[model samples]
Target chain A: MPSVDNNASPPSTKKPLYEASTQFKNWRYSPDHLAHIRSTLNEAAVGVIRKTFEAYEPGSSSNVSFVTADEEHLLVTFYIHKIGQLCGHFRFPEEVEATAASYLKRFYLKNTVMDWHPKNVMLTALFLATKTTNNPISLDAYTSHIPNTIASDVLDLEFLVAQSLRFEFAVWHAHRALWGIWLDIQNLPNTPPDFAKTESAIYDSALTHVRAARLTDAEFIYTPSQIALACISLVAPDLANQWLESKENTPIPESRVDIPPRPSSTAISASLEAIRNMITNSGKVPHVEAVREVDKRLKLCKNPEKVVGTKAYLARKAEAEKKAEEKRNKKVEGQKANDRDPFGQELGEPAAKPGLVDYDDESDDE
Target chain B: MDAVERENSDRQKSWAKEQKVGEGTYAVVYRGREVSTGRRVAIKKIKVGQFKDGLDMSAIREVKYLRELKHQNVIELLDVFSSKTNLNLVLEFLDSDLEMIIKDRSLVFLPADIKSWMAMTFRGLEFCHRNFVLHRGFKMTCQVITPVLRWYRPPELLFGSRFYSSAVDIWSVGCIFAELMLRTPYLAGESDMDQLKTIFRALGTPTEQEWPGHTKLPDYVPVGQFPKTPLRDLFTAASADTLNLLSKCLLYEPRKRLSASEVCGCCSYGSPLYIIPISSPFRYPSHPSKLPKCSTQMAPRPLEEVDGNVDMAGTGPGVKAAAPSKVKLKRKLTSPADESRTRSIARKLDFTKQVNSP
Candidate 1:
């Protein structure tokens, strides 16, 4: 028999709720905050694009375009789903899919879809998530499914995506927590003999909801365990209630949650409330809108000369060419100088002159 | 500058580097202090120049795990920031490590002292395991020492198991416990083959009956018959219970090895020291009734009787109790050849460096 010696205190994955609160404060985003950030980014991008265009056509304001938060979020969600499909085609681990989705979500949090093309960003996020999670695929392998993409396209933006997330690549998934909870139920005393098949069915259904829950911003607002519990509660409220009752007296792991081991009933209820709110909030289908104009504006930003040769673009290009020419001229001059004097004369000490004061001799005389 | 760069610069300004304390393969460590709080910190500047990739894999793993891990024994990563070319991880400043203490002949380690260290190591490891983290590499360094001593690495790892679990760390802790008893590396081998030989020699050759899948390992090889050395023979001074626990930890089968929590539960068998359960809210058991009654001869001296200034935590500055003169004399007596041997152990794990004020 397995030794029960260390069974004095059973290990658990449930941390205190405070850790969840801190994680939320660190990485979570409220809808209002997302809206505020997205709008601000859109306004800034539009102002820059407009100013650049206006430099070429002094009186034209018609070319300036803006992406609404709704349209931008729709684009983001579309690409996130695209990332999931891409991972599925690649047959990467579930973590790759989760991470790619998370990367897309996090990237859009601080950035506007107009600033960087979502298609390129989405591909980069998938490529990076694949590499980070240890199922590293070559750039060729990564871009094989997507057309008109190359290694540099994804490789160049890797640092940008990583920097946006501040290199915090660790993402918790509800699947593991849900699996743990299911096992906990099976291990409990007097679990029905035939409960295994039903438990598997319940778990499968709960996992389906968890996937749907991910398409929402529940990850930002709630911990993985909370989301998992909420997913279970949605399908198997009786089992969840049973699980809650079992956990009522048993203390939660301090590592998982920073709160008291035996949390007050109010704290537990408040968590349940937050999880329910997340599930409901996620249930609503997002309104989709056209983002063609925004995409065009982004394309124009990449190559302003394509649509209109703005004075600023022309002048900047001319200045860059002039600098390059001057750099070439300097290189030619340096080579000529080197040919004339192999050991550069300026680097050698100045020739001693009779008229120059000998400071060392003077000091010796003193 | 971009927003990411701006944020990084702000984080950089918050911590003030006092001086360069140590340097290793992957990072240069600095003694630092938080600007506002004046709290001591060790800033490990990771060398990004080597990897064409943005950040080193080990740095990423360290940050990924250490950021979430919170325990007294585990080294805490306070903040992570990138400077012009290097990634700086602001870690809790730990002054010394087990290697230094073990090497210092001036200090004598009692059974109680070893027990305390084991308790703390297991406590930290138990949390890591429960959190689904496997400290694949655990070695003694200037920072918080881990269980994966080269001499202590488990047989599975040596056999090249890519998907090993927490059992690997238990083998390391067992090696450390034995090291404490022997005052030298128990199985310090020159090479992988030699190391395996030493392990087998000490614990007998594993057959299919003993380790069902031993032959299936990628690097596994058949060794000639060798009788197992009795634990009491190796650890002559250790109690019977201590020997029993050691055997469990060093079990050939990875599945049979006691887990970190299991090790914690068995603490009563080996030492009077209270093992702190990772998840339990209760403090260390204080009641004498809960304490196991062991032979008085084998029992450790009362905690008060041990040297108070020895720095048992291994997180504080080098022990002040060891007389400077004696330590110097001991160093002087050791041959230059012996000094060179000390450098043989590669300092691969560069997590934190203790900054000594000159």
Candidate 2:
């Protein structure tokens, strides 16, 4: 038999992993990526919370609806804030945020606002953030601050979320290119320590800008590298300017008069103008105070006091276990009832079966 | 009353007369009598619980295809009905199958008789092939020898594999033809592998060059490489006309094998219906309805004053008397060579024992 050339194409331009007739085509996303995202944002921290509240006061009455809506909104906002906090805490590569955002967007594509609570969705987003950065957070600690009701459906929802995304979780972020540029600057001969420090400041400032941009519509459109660069240039222009000034002041350590000089202030100013135009056209910049406040509240609420402590935690844990036990019992009872009434008697099987079978048999006999 | 109640009542009326005939993988065929019409029918009962995967689409493939086949040679499907627990298929009852006749060694056929049987078998097979049905399990058992023993299988069917097209049925026809001539199975191996070797010994082993896609067959493997043998060696005692027809039917390549219609055209023997009347001892009264009309008309025989004391040995010019010397010669040349060669290949085929037969 002739051997097929499996490696004829490069990895970047490989064909679809699944065949056309495969059932995976029907699935929302790749199986593995869906699994990864689901595990990270287990429904225990998000799904059950919404269900519990909905069940506690079930009705389409305006008051009930309004209350649920308010709580849901608060929960979603808290999740977004926590994501921002994780962004700062982990010093996650800018790509991690972009990856996390993409996961959240893709997850919601198949899912509805009503099906899974925003809380679990947020926790999953954060969990994905950790993974995208190559840093995994334990599910135990991740769900620790979640209310028992919210935490109940976390694990179950994880699978649903993973399925929704189709498991293609490879996300590229903007910070990768920024880091590349930093590496290039570091290798340049006679680069001073202060100049490097200034450069580092510029990188930090870039991250801040990226974080701010996330709250705006611009985050939806810009790639991670573009966001990172734009953010850095916007946040800490002085540091970048100072680094350039130092280079110009302390140049010619070697007889390199023939060397091409760095770009002048005029060129730098023109480039800055172009970057500003790009950012302005992208979207309205979100308010800095609002972004910070949301970020702080997210960090604080992520580990709320109600979710911590041995006794409170155990009580909440036991409550969750009890609810799960009830649900299991209900399902088993339903199955037993179905088996006992094989003819679907609840829909009046006794009246239906005789007429259907008896007439056909007689006609055949004749 | 609702449909279910009416169906149950109808079933009860006929259920008492239902007698089991055979059971397949998913259905039980029962001999049934319609009380009102007094018509005999074969009812296939399929129980829902017996199916491992519940009533799936594949289980219906055979029923759907068979329903459309309306040829005289093919079994007719009359109706289909379903109850709460089972699906019932109503088919026209066939009296006795060809396998039972073949197994009854007491019966013997003349040369013309064998040729007529071969011709009918090919006619039926050609119809099925043109209609795009493979009849994958075309053993003697599947072929119905209506009224009496007569060959009606194609060769491709003799080569039992589900993947084949109509060519499989043609292979079974070849096997039936061999059985008619020799009064035994051409390749009666105990297992599938044994059967392949049996075919190889008689037809000679197929090489990759001869059968271009043979290597791609799911069951294909290199069993001890045997040199090819000519067809004449296998059918040494067969007449020139018979041998030519047999070789065409038993071609190794499915595409190269003669079609069912082609087999009908190539048949040297006349219609089997003439042989039936000649073989029967009863003298019939002159009545047109009593006699079946052959699709192709035969040369008219003298109707009045026909001699009831006609000689059995010299009835027709086409009929040949069985000779002991010819049988002995065939047995000596082919059977021993086939047995010894199969025994050698069987030893090499033992490695396949570990793999479970599907």
Best-fitting candidate, measured by DockQ?
1
Docking class of 2: incorrect
lDDT of 1 by residue, B35-135 (tens): 89988677777665455544534455566556666654566678887654566889776543456557767666556555545665676666666656555
RMSD of 1: 13.7
Residue A244 in candidate 1, Cα distance off native in Å: 5.6
Model 2 residue runs over 4 Å out of place are A1-366, B1-16, B23-25, B56-58, B142-163, B207-209, B213-219, B225-237, B265-358
Q: What is the TM-score of chain B alone in each candidate?
A: 0.73, 0.62
Model 1 lDDT, full chain set? 0.61
Q: Which ranges of candidate 1 are over 4 A from the true structure?
A: A1-14, A17-25, A29-63, A181-206, A229-294, A297-366, B16-40, B49-56, B142-149, B206-218, B239-241, B265-358
Tell me how large the interface RMSD of candidate 1 is: 15.1
